[model samples]
Target chain A: MFNAIVSAGTLGTALDSVSVLVEECKIHLNDDGIAIRAVDPANVGMVDLTLSEAAFESYEADGGVIGVNLSRLQDIAGMASSDDLVHLELDEETRKLHISIDGLEYTLALIDPDSIRQEPDIPDLDLPATIVLEGRDIDRAVTAADMVSDHIALGVNEDDEQFYVDAEGDTDDVHFELDRDDLIDLTAGPAHSLYSLDYLKDMNKAIPSNAEVTLDLGEEFPVKFHFDIAEAEGSVTFMLAPRIQSD
Target chain B: MFNAIVSAGTLGTALDSVSVLVEECKIHLNDDGIAIRAVDPANVGMVDLTLSEAAFESYEADGGVIGVNLSRLQDIAGMASSDDLVHLELDEETRKLHISIDGLEYTLALIDPDSIRQEPDIPDLDLPATIVLEGRDIDRAVTAADMVSDHIALGVNEDDEQFYVDAEGDTDDVHFELDRDDLIDLTAGPAHSLYSLDYLKDMNKAIPSNAEVTLDLGEEFPVKFHFDIAEAEGSVTFMLAPRIQSD
Candidate 1:
């Protein structure tokens, strides 16, 4: 049995982060907290989310996994205001999830966990370059690049000690460069990778503009973005595989 | 020759009024003011708009008719803020209309006046009932009715001394009524008409919420809605033919 109360904003952000990667996920609940790890169907992106018991207003649970439909949860979340408190409860007999916001209650049938795809194991990588900066800075660069091209190259200029995002179109190109002084922290190294902007654009929507985000990059390897949620009571990590660059 | 400067809001409102009915029209410019009269292609609605010379910051013209594409004008107007000044000039030599706003100039090719549809003569009708109220009041009723039905009935109740807007669906209905105290004025004579909500919805977008609107109604007859524009420096009239009510 499990029952909890959390701020609507925090629950909505967590659902949004996972919905971008997959439509369904198995949320594991225990005395410690709730956690989810899933990968996209194309195997190009993966998401990891965790919320501590402190993140909830009230928490009580027996360790178990509940399969959830993220899209339906997102729709219910859309009806709530940011500061509204959301109550969630599991009905073991009916195998349903009860969500309450304000005076409205929504009961959604839970998916069978055995029917869902097996979770992916987190891969280990030795990325050499890392940068930390405000989420808005990366959001701005992604928006500008989307207007010019479908793919963007992220690279660290060791000689100039700057990180740059560049997009080249048939008729025009957009480029944004930020030095160490402009970023919160930078460990510059020879690292460059090309990635599809489509996934990045969707992921950008879940990021809070003023929050700090850390990016890990390497030559022709997957990229990792990490950020805190629920006022740092929880954390989320998004990993996206790089697309092969074409000359 | 014609050269004038008007607030972007005034110009936008004028274009919006005409674009609702027809895409192209003949604008009459004289020493008195600017005017347009056109009917929709389906002949179900007609729009008449007039703006006095005093409405513009500067006005000069040699009386003539210029064919205009209202949709194109709307696009240009959309780029300007409401308070920005818009300069309009007729280039007879080039047979084009030049619109300048905020250092951006857009030149559009004009359609031949002779190739456009002939202007319609204003119909004369004797309506038994007239109601004057805030535009927002009528706008609200229309919006609510749209969700329940495809057509709405507008009438005055002599017994209750009130006016009402009502819509009935297969299983649901919506009604809004206002008494004399709630209206600016009311000439309560027995009147009722059923009109398609599609046209009313489109026209509602052009009506400023805070302004006053006068509606004239008659049994099974066309309805007339009159409102002021450009801060009361001009006026616009919309007439819509009533639909045959199905019992």
Candidate 2:
């Protein structure tokens, strides 16, 4: 059983993060908080999200797992104003989730958790570089890259102590760089990697423009993006597999 | 030949006012100003627009008529910010309109004015009722009415001295009323008419929310909407034929 009340903005952001990768996800509910881990069907990207009890106005839960359709939740959330208080309650007997906001009520049928794909184990990676910047900075870079190519290269120049994004098209290219002075923080290391712009574009939508986002990278390896939500009460991390370059 | 410089916002508004009725229009240019009159193919709606020399930052013209593809002009206008200055020059030798904004330049081939549809003669109507209100007020009414039906009735109640918009759908109805206190001005007359919402919706997009719009109506007659553009230096009038109600 689980019940909680949260601001629409917080709920929308959390749902958007997971929904970008998967339409359906298994939500793990516990006395301490809620957790969701999902990967896109193509296996190109994955998202791990956790919302602590502190993220909610009120919360109560007995450890359990439930499958939910993220798209449906997004629609209901779309009806609410950012500041509106959203109340959610799960009915164990009926296997449905009850949602209420400003007198409007909706009962969303939940899927059996056992039917969902098994959650994968989170891999342990010791990346060599770390960079922190405002979400909008990276979002803008991703947008510019999309205009030039389907994939973008992200790296750090150790000598210059700078992070850069580069996209090369058939005849055109785009390059963006942010030095230590421009970034919140930077750890220059061997961090050159290429990733698909499609996945990055989708993930960027979930990040609030003003939020500080951390990126961890390694040569030709997956890039990890981490950002706090709900005033740092909750957090989300996205991992995107790199595209091997061909000569 | 014609040469002019105007703010993107003023030019965009002028083009939008005419483009909504016809995709191709004959622009009549003279030393004093510019004028356009066009009717939709279905003859259900008509637009008359005028922009004086005062509307532009710089203006010069020799009396001439040029046919233009509005959709192309709109695309060029879309590239400019509302406050940006847009330059237009007619290259008589090439019969092209040279448009430049913020260093970006485009030359649009002009259509032969003789090849386009002949201009329509605007009918003179003696509508008895006159009402003036904020563009947003009517826009809201139109939006609400759209939710209920395809056609909306616009009328002024002589006894109540109020103007109202009403729509009836298969299962629901919407009604909005504004008396003298709620309007900028009102002159009651026998003015009850039904009009297609499709036309009003398109016309509403060109009306600035803060603009003071004047409406002239009569019993079962076409309704005329008049509003100023370019800070009163230009004006647009839209006339829509009423959908006769069959009892």
Which candidate leads the pack in DockQ?
Answer: 2
- Stretches of candidate 1 off by over 4 Å are A1-247
Report lDDT (Cα) of residue A45, candidate 2: 90
TM-score of every model?
0.53, 0.55
Residue A210 of model 1, lDDT score = 91
Candidate 1 per-residue C-alpha lDDT over A33-140 given as tens digits, one digit per residue, 9 for 90 to 100? 899999988888888899989999999888989998887777666656788898889989988887766434456678999877778776878799999989999899
Candidate 2 residues B51-101, lDDT tens each? 999999999999988989897787667666799998988989978787776
What's the count of clashing pairs in each model shown? 0, 0
Off by over 4 Å in 2: B1-247
Q: What are the candidates' interface root-mean-square deviations? A: 11.0, 9.6
TM-score (chain A) of candidate 1? 0.96
Chain A TM-score of model 2 comes to 0.97
Error in Å for residue A117 of model 2: 2.2
TM-score of 2: 0.55
Winning candidate number (lDDT)? 2
Worst 10 residues of 1 chain B by lDDT: B167-176
Instruction: Write one digit per residue (lDDT tens) for candidate 1, span B87-152.
Output: 999999988989999889999899899988989887888899999988888777776666558998
